[model samples]
Target: MADDPTKKGPADRTRVSTSEAHELRYWSEKFGVSHDELKRAVAAVGNSAEKVEAYFRDRSRDARR
Candidate 1:
């Protein structure tokens, strides 16, 4: 089955669904970033949530320098 539109979060927690507004909101909130930032991260890396989170961690470290 497809994702439930009424769901608050993504059906698959391991991936980011850029095509879904709720997915963007959920991921952005979880990562404490804006929607655009999340989208950029997804694009730069891939849809893998683990990779996206790792990308943010790396970015955070880079920002500290």
Candidate 2:
């Protein structure tokens, strides 16, 4: 996926909160992924929240390198 952080529109930005950011950070750390990778996975999964969660759960074992 592309690395454009601006891909999400302004309205979409409002959907995330500080707490959510912290949560994402925690998950990213636990899963051994960059925050950007977590964001990309979420974006790729779109509205499917389950798929987004599953992506992290399934990929956590893979080394980042």
Per candidate, the number of residue pairs that clash is: 0, 0
Candidate 1 residue lDDT tens string, 1-65: 27677888888899988887777788999999999999999999999999999999999999999
Clashes of 2: 0
Winner by TM-score: 1
User: What's the distance in Å from true for residue 31, model 2?
Assistant: 2.3
Measured by TM-score, how close is model 2 to the native structure? 0.42
lDDT of each: 0.90, 0.54
Clashing pairs in 1: none
Model 1 scores a TM of 0.89
Question: What's the lDDT of the predicted structure labeled candidate 2?
Answer: 0.54
Compose the digit string of candidate 2's lDDT tens values, residues 1-65.
23334533223332321125555555466446777886787677653446666777767647463
